[model samples]
Target chain A: MNKSILTKREKEVFELIIENYTTTEIALKLKISEKTVRNHISNVMQKLGVKGRASAVVELLKLGELSI
Target chain B: MIKRRFIKKVLVTSAVLFAFLLMCLIPNNNVLEPTQQLEYVSSEVNKIPIYLLDSHNMLGRTNVAINSKEIDKQARELLEILIKEKGDNKLPSGFKAIIPSETVINSLTYKDGLIKVDFSSSLLDVSTENETKVIEAIVYTLTGIEGVNKIIIYVDGNILTKLPKSKINLPSTLDRSYGINRDYSITSYHDITSFNVYYLSKYNDVEYYVPVTKYVNDSRDKVEIIVEELKQGSYDNNLMSYLNYQTELEKVDYDKNEIALTFNEYIFSDADNREVLDEVISAISLSIADSYNVEEVVFNYKNEEIHKSVIKMLE
Candidate 1:
């Protein structure tokens, strides 16, 4: 709802991460490579300066960049 | 009259001697000043980046004096410096040319940011182990020249699309993306990401950087990958990383083509002095310049700015 820090693709990837979509399942659902799925997560994590995907999701929610 | 004539002669002789001495002193003063001599020398020679194989058989970059100013001529001159047979005398101590000694450049043409170099059959004389290194040395050295972004290597007028010994396929146009000192650690062929990371290597106690192009299945951003690998240190015994394993990167922030890294206090070599080792700085800046497009990197410890480095300055 606030200024979005995550890119469109990154938002989609995180939205799926919040839904508990596995990396492989997210890749299949998005019709992208599993590596690409991981890359998206990694990119967002890097922007947020967090170490893991869960932390990234938590930070995004705190920043109001994502909604569950 | 005799006395007067003698006096005149003496005066004339003295006057001539004085003039002769003045002329000699004037010439010495007219000799080129040291500053002027240095300017003349720098004008006639350029310090160009030349990537050469070091004692450990890794490509280490060193600047070599070149006399050419024209782009085409400079490219040929650098290529000559990269050839083992021709460039031996030009190389710095402990460095060797990666190109095979017998290789000969048939022709070279440069236009529109691309250089096409045709080499004779002898170019393939390199051993299988050094085949990729030879290519890397060429690509990195040539691209070091200003305005040269791409290169096309040809053997006898045919595009060299594959390495004869290693059988590694090469694109028709080669650039930094081709990577130097390639190390593959990927689990699967699919979804491979390649990034360049600089590691420190020593020759005769002198430290230099060797860039390794790592191909891994990890899909992390390049900065993250570089930091992680540098922290892991070099797998090769010859290469080393100065980054402390305990150092942790806390946050990455970007603004206006610059990236800032915030790290723990462990990043400093001497916490009391707030000092980061030069080798550590070079390793990080060089790796970041090669992998990331940012023009500057700012190093921070505990949210305080410690050092700022320009990417071009590192290169």
Candidate 2:
């Protein structure tokens, strides 16, 4: 996965979204606002030219930003 | 004949107003019939409260009702609502999401009463000042789920031990034990005891109850602490008012499934209207239910059972 395309946080959020954690659970786990989590996902999506959480995750895995 | 008609009209209007006011005072939906109460008891969905920042930037809780009985599912739904720019719950507009936008959850697991949730790293982007509030919102929201007693947070599958900006050390496992909305002003030499309590807040002139975990260094019972907090009024001015200053806790008793509180006449006499009275009942019930094992909170005035709230008994 070409991990350079996404910020560290964005990659982390993308990986988690792919893992199936909900926004609230992510916020609780990371000790940050759910808004920030979404922001990271949106940022990744914007960067990858993708739409939706699952698509971003799939693109990241393909780009080597994430893995199986 | 015209004067008689006018007098009759005035009487009818006043009677209607009286009934409306009475309806306002009584526990409207709370007094549910057995079948309707059963719906809540056997509900497939859970009503979980997610704490968010209000217009004043103080911690305010909004309950999100979801159709999933699974705790993990409920937590996810709550996260979705909490992260949204605007909450999907019935809470009024002034209440805003505390979690920064774009954050997402990776997974949530429960084992032996401990809930472990993994999230994306974007969760680290919250401002330092909101660090504690963010934790409070998360802890309060997760712990609100029954059987889920503690929380362990992770980022990208890695356990988070400290906050990024604030560097606040996190407990390996966090529960209500960590405390929410710390009452730092309380000065005592002894160790502090922390627990969750519900308080009142208003949005659009409608009163909503918010749960907060508070710390006290005193030896008072948890029930007394709840009453005392209510009497102090909400520290946040934007929140609603409750509990007359003179509303003292006359007596308190509790068993495994019930707690009874006797308050001074101020509780009844000081309630300016039914709405305020309902607020009082809710504040008391919701707060006391958090820390105590009791299922019913009985309110008494002058040694008589004035009203009883089954807050804990509710599903």
Candidate 3:
């Protein structure tokens, strides 16, 4: 909805994050490093023109990229 | 001007949306629909490995006892597997007879020469035949685990007054499952150390056999020690040496509330660290807990604390 693309992995991480996973939880679930999850989250925020976590989540929800 | 308007809108919109979202996600003052609350075997992956499932999957091996301080556990698992795969009769709705879906294995300890297995349950009412089958399943099964020789079963966190007649004889014969016994029966009893068990090499694996003679010539205490040492060395030699266990079971007395445990040695060396002491204490606590009916297992040091490591099993 923000005209930005979400890679498959990023999309997966976002879905989990919205499901209330902490950063470490997401890393464990994906079997990736916590730093890698952070990197993707940063990219997600930048692509959506958001500065931080709350806005990124809100923007994703607004664009219907997420479901409750 | 545009930025100020957008910032105001963002704050107001986020506050309302977040409140609404939070309300939806959290269950608070929500009206409930009439619902059925039936329970199923919890599919939680990290739950206690039902002894039956573990044994059914043939975890560890029949040739050796499971020694991770969980023989009762392994036996319970063996029973559960036998029940699920083998099935049972007169089992109640929530009552499982053979494969105990969940059982808490507190600890197995080897102090002096005696081995103690502690479990959390009251197994007295389990049918006599079921009990005997379960014990034999454990004893025979534990023969495959490490750090166990003879076992005293405990249920509901205490020892029983009488062993159920689900009696299975303890055999020293070489069974290929624990290892191999290609020449097990052929080993000569001569030159066998007093009270020591003998094993013969066969088919690339070790086969165990009780010495042809009973340990009658030695003190019962000494035989108990020899068997425990063999058990400690059963699976991982490193584990046997890790505790550096030097104490002997001096006397073990019990009441419903507490068990009095004594040892021959002071049990720690000048070289040992707190961690070593902790492991030793836990091992003893779990073992003693398994052998008696009690809440606390008091050690010989005159009011020493119950070991914490073994207590963690309760959690």
TM-score of chain B of each: 0.80, 0.75, 0.31
Which tens-of-lDDT digit does each residue in B111-133 have in candidate 3? 33234556555334445535533
Q: Write one digit per residue (lDDT tens) for candidate 1, span B1-315.
A: 999999999999999999999988774545555653222334688778788989987898777888889989999999998888786667888898878888889999999999999999899988888888888898998887878889999999999877768454566788898788767664432334678898988888877788898866566677888999999998799989999999888899999889999999989999999999988888998888777768799999878899999866664
| Regions more than 4 Å wrong, model 2 | A1-68, B1-46, B84-92, B195-197, B269-276, B312-315
Worst 10 residues of 1 chain B by lDDT: B33-42
Point to the candidate with the largest TM-score: 1
C-alpha RMSD over true interface residues, each candidate:
17.6, 20.6, 34.1
DockQ of each: 0.02, 0.02, 0.00
What count of clashes does model 1 give?
0
Residue B173, model 3: lDDT of 21
Backbone Cα, N, C clashes tallied per candidate: 0, 24, 26
* Alpha-carbon lDDT of model 1: 0.82
TM-score head-to-head 1 vs 2, winner: 1
Per residue, candidate 1 scores C-alpha lDDT tens digits across A1-68 of 22367788998887877665788988999999999998998888898898876567556544446542
TM-score of each predicted structure versus truth: 0.68, 0.63, 0.28
Q: Residue B120 in model 1: shift from native, Å?
A: 2.2
